[model samples]
Target: MPYKRIKWLILWTPTVTIALWEYIRHTFLLPYLSMDLGNALAPVIVLTVTVTLVYKLFHLLEQTSDSLQRERLAKAAFVEREQLARELHDGISQSLFLLSVKLDKLEHTQDKESVQATAQQIRKTVKHVYDDVRQSIASLRSEPSMTEVQWMQSVEEMAVELRLGGLQVELDWRLTDSDLTSKEKIELLAIVREAMLNVQKHARAKRLIVNAFKAENISAGGFNCTIMDDGIGVDDPALEAKGRYGVRMMRDRANAMGWQFEVGRNDSKDNNQTVGTVVAVTKGG
Candidate 1:
């Protein structure tokens, strides 16, 4: 039952029970019983009955409230998934159509260099679009009930779908014993998805690794998540100009969740020219 309703019930239940007992006794039972004796016996009977009835009613109300809450949540999840599906259909479908037209033109054209470049560009665009659709589907299907381990499993599954040079993902789960709240799991999953999507779209790296570890000099339950890829290093100044909203969005999400977000080039330990990108997030417990 709602708090207000329960409050009112508590206030009025005793009053109504006593008033009914008094009315019954005055109208029909005073002649058979003494006033003092009737008053004591009537309250006992009225109190017992009131207690039983209130217990049953409140139990039923609580059950109904729980059922309604679950139903509402289910409906909301369904609507969100449907909206995501429609957006994917509209965006990816158009891109695929344009890609088909380009492929057809390339097949009929005699120009070698132009045909090769167009084909390569179309291939990259197709892969990026496919990755986007997969990520959207994965996000829509994800549930807050998932635990950290289960969330990581889902991430691995999504990684398999990337199919970038058979992109190998190494997960270093140092914080496996840690417990994360449902909201934390969802937010962390979103950050991971954005990171992986960036790798799929721009990294062009053969290997990707995600490391989860406890953060140093932080409060209890603080942890850090980092994704490293041997891709081209990011240019901080040109990122926004290059229309890379994914990185910005990830940073914004981390900040909103009170996590520290960092993205930059992974310094080469061996001093080789093979620079890479690193995206890291540190969150408090």
Candidate 2:
């Protein structure tokens, strides 16, 4: 009987201690100790509590140290990103400008072979530089500023530029001019631009919607820009498709800007006439 009791006690050791400390603290340790023992034993109690708290304090300090390190690292990364953005915009981006100018001057040349060769080289170089800057810009995700009018001008200008490059372009806007932030405007424009490029390259849509505005529930304030085409729409988004690449890229760009990126075709319930890939972005109300 004694051996059995001892074995049970060993098994219940933790539980008994928990019951004493939690349920029977007054009878366990308080009544036997003097209330005025504080004067005599305050230091010991305080020291015991403080010693236990010291571990928490150390954990807090370690967390603070980690936060400081993270902030420093993030700052360094931002600085580097800015530096790279500026250099590419200033340096290689300028190279595109030069090439454009030289190509312009060569328009009067009569040598078919030379002209073709020169044009091919120009295309190759310009594409390489553009891809580089685009990669860099995509990486940095730099936010540039513009008023509503300026924003319109920038998008239209880019559309015209693309049109001149032999890609069809269209601009249709219903979102009124208001206090849209620089970041918001840029994000929306990026969606339009990516969608346009997708239409040109993947969808093989002859016609394009370069700048389109969409709204729901409220007008002007609560609005989104959309780009729709008559090209091939990806039937399944879960599977990788040509148009989906642009859709996914646009969605990601919008997400990074805290905006909702929406992709749909016009054949559904609300709008079935919508034939091709549609890129949409929502703005503030």
Candidate 3:
């Protein structure tokens, strides 16, 4: 039976049974039994029925709740594993593939300068793959519940990291902790960190701005997070060659959470000139 129905039965069954017993005792049983005797028996009968019925109903309700909780935990674990697999495929696996290709090129190369360049590329690819592995391990070990202050601190840390690379960074965060769940905060922080890394490595911009706020234009309960850089814009071939994997991972993460992800060139309003690149992740609309 459904949970609500079981609760209703538990609540009303005893009362209804007592009322019916009283009506029968007064109307028919009184002819055969004394009024005092009937009244004395009523308490014992009601107590026995209520205890038995309530015990059985309570057991059923507890079982139903436990089953639902187990199902939810199982589903959440499955989704987490799937996302981890995708991250490995997009980040480390692709980097390893590129590393193999570079090794093959190194074998055939005869010139000294070319060999040095290929070896350098191999080392860079290996370092990137190593970083990805470490990041995955850290994520697996991270606490599941993150406070609002911790979330903000994580974002600030990313900004501080970028500053060390000689890029000017500004933050304009408006969304409160209530705006997103624990899982949502983790995924959003990952996306933002990826965007900042892209800017650090490939944007070649003098300034970068990060913004997070509720966006009415998107939809009800919608949020917008944008990372803007005054860099070479979306037309840069270097970003396409080196930063494509990170971008793909970001998009995949956002899509997995049913959010919108977009990357485009930031353009001037008065003129048609491209100013920089904008990476946005939005929820709802």
Candidate 4:
């Protein structure tokens, strides 16, 4: 029961009991010393007890409410910190990648030109940025994305929870033979992971189908992951927009990769109302 209801019981039970006792004593002990003293003393004692009991009950309720609120606030703070750390790792590290690429192009030349010397300076600067980004990433969050095997492992682990919950999920993936950087892997994993969570939550999905492929989109290349589920569809037009930081996090990861991010409903041939959400990451447009 809620604290308010408990308080109501506490207040009313005592008041009723005291009133019944006074009525009985007055009716039965009428001939005894029914003096001004008894009349004055009985009311004073009853009021004192009522005040004391009500105060204590209120104090208990106040303490419990404060403790629960403190716990909720602490949890919110922790989640906020984790989100900030993830953003710094995924966002700040991109500069290091660009710097490293430029430095590499400048490094390999038999020609002892000013460009070569400038390349050395650029290499040194890139190294500094790389070290800082790595340190911050270590302090933040990640899942390796460098190889196909690691990417698959990350996806499987992410879905292990659903398996534990007894949901039937089928995950299939295809990767480009080309290797990806660690930062790219994290971006891909975070984006895919967020989409998976949405499927588990709003979809009420008993069965899920995930297909990932690597392909070129125009001049840009990207990894595409399509998730289909036999679950209830959402009606909100702004579900993708006004929803919490989940969509924001997905978009942020996609932005860092210069990838196009698309997600929403599509056709279900079985008529069991299976809907799909596709997240295509292409070179940033």
Candidate 5:
């Protein structure tokens, strides 16, 4: 039986049954049965029915709760797997594409210096792919309860890596541990990392800045993270020719976390020249 129907039955059955029993005892059974005997049996009958109904109701509730819990776990696992697949497509796949392009160049080059350079580039691409795979594995093994300091260290490590590539990187982080929830922090970090990688791979800029702060006017949660680079602006033709999966993935991550994602050329103080590109992810306003 449906829980609601059983609950209603349990509530009304005892009262109605006792009322009818009393009516029959007084109106008809009084001739044969004593009032004391009828009254004495009424409590026992009510107790039996009440106990049975209570047990059934509790059992149904427990079963419902357990089913809901299992559904939640299954859904969470599916989402995690989907995210890992996307990361592989965006990170490792892109590196392999670069490696293939370098190999094509190596095949056509005749000069010894050019051939050596192309081979070096291929080696770097292969190393990058290896690192990406290792990072993905590490992420899967990482604890969910990552501290704010650890997150900051991760961002700093990314900046250091960019520096090794000869890009000047700056960090201006102002968020505290309480600024965002654990899931929010994770998604935001992913978006930032994607932006930085795009700059390192395609921006052709000398300097980059990563800024994170609270801005009530710009975000509902008063939180925002921006990646600004003095690279070829967003209007560059080469960017469009390259696939936009990285940008699309970053936008999807922000949207999934209920955040706002925007990418455009930075506003220049001097209107005569275009500046670098800027990518911002903000808590939805």
Candidate 6:
């Protein structure tokens, strides 16, 4: 029962019980017991009933709340599993397809130079697939502690993986290990990973620069992360369409955390050509 109802019940139960006892004392229980005795016992009976009923009702409410919470967590876990499955399928399937093509080429070509190049490409692709699987497994198996140094290390590892895809990555870290919440850290890690994956899958960039650190001049008392890629620069309509999902997901993560996200082509000072793509996010205080 709700608190209001319980409060009202406790407030009115004594009066109602006394009224009933007065009406029934002369007719109902007087034949078996004295009127004064009946009056004394009626209040005790009412008190017992009130206490027992309130205790049982509150216990039920507590149980129900616990059950609802468990259900919610279960649902969230299911959704996360489904999303991971989709990501692995998309990423691993592409790598496997490329690997198969290279193998086929190696089998058909008799030229030593062509075979050597194909074998090298296969090794690189295999390493990338291995890294992806390892990261995915880690994400599934455990939630890492939200420590600043560890989070940065994970970003560095991701940068290493991007290097496997031939993207040169530069990391600029300046943030102090303070004031970041666990939720913020998790969301930031996810956003960074997704952004890097997008770069590897579609950016076709030769160089990527990731700057993540605290800024003293920022109004929102939070850190900043900018990922710049010197690639074809998100100009191709087909590539844009393919990358839209990742961009949307990153934006959603930032918005959900009350952060700011911006993505666009980095135009040169001459304004004559697209230089690269920049994905920038700023977390709010």
Put the candidates in lDDT order, highest first: 3, 5, 6, 1, 4, 2
lDDT of 4: 0.63
lDDT of 1 by residue, 1-285 (tens): 565677578567778888888888899988998989987887697779677977766776687778879999999988786556544543364346446656766787688987887788679769867876776667645543554246576566546445422567777767653556666776677678678767766788777788888767767878889988877777778567656656766776688789989888877642343548888899764
Better of 3 and 5 by TM-score: 5
What lDDT does candidate 2 reach at residue 25? 38
Give all TM-scores, in the order shown.
0.48, 0.57, 0.51, 0.45, 0.54, 0.55
lDDT of 4 at 212: 73
Report the lDDT tens digits of candidate 6 across residue range 1-285.
554565566567667866776777777767889767886888787777667865665666677667778999999998787567545753575567557756766888899987897788889889979977886776654544565236666677667656644568888777655657777777787777777767776667777777888777676557889887767777546434854666766777789888989887777622233447888889764
> What TM-score does candidate 1 get on C-alpha atoms?
0.48
The residue-by-residue lDDT of candidate 4 on 1-285, one tens digit each, is 466775686668577757876777688765774667567767776777667876676777788788879989999889768666565534344334335544554565456775766576566656756765665657444343355236556578646645644467788777643645667766676677666766765677787777777656543445566667776655437455564456667777776677777666665564564565444455433
> How many steric overlaps are in each model, in order?
0, 4, 0, 4, 0, 0
When summed lDDT is taken over every stretch of 10 residues in candidate 5, the lowest stretch is 140-149
Q: Please report, as a residue range, the 10-residue window in candidate 2 with the lowest summed lDDT.
A: 1-10
Q: Write the per-residue lDDT of candidate 3 for residues 1-285, one digit (tens) a residue.
A: 887888898898889878988999988888998979988888988888877987888899899888878999999998788667755864576567556656777898899998998788788779988987887777753544675226777568657646744688989999888988888888898788778767866678888889999987877778999998888888545445753778877887899899999887878531333458999899987
Q: Which candidate is the best by lDDT?
A: 3
Off by over 4 Å in 2: 1-38, 52-142, 147-150, 174-179, 211-220, 238-245, 255-260, 267-274
| Candidate 4 residue pairs that clash | 145-185, 258-283, 258-284, 260-282
Worst 10 residues of 3 by lDDT: 266-275
Per-residue CA lDDT of candidate 5, range 1-285, in tens?
554665676578789878877888889989998778888988987777667865676677677667778999999998888778776865687567557656766888899998887788778879889988987787754534565226676577667657755688889999987988787777787678778878877778888888999986864566878898888878635444557778878878888877788887775732343448989887856
Candidate with more favorable, higher TM-score: 1 or 6: 6
Better of 2 and 3 by TM-score: 2
Sum up the clashes in candidate 1: 0
lDDT scores of the candidates, listed in order: 0.70, 0.60, 0.79, 0.63, 0.76, 0.71
Local error of candidate 5 at residue 1 (angstroms): 10
Estimate the overall C-alpha local distance difference test score of candidate 2.
0.60
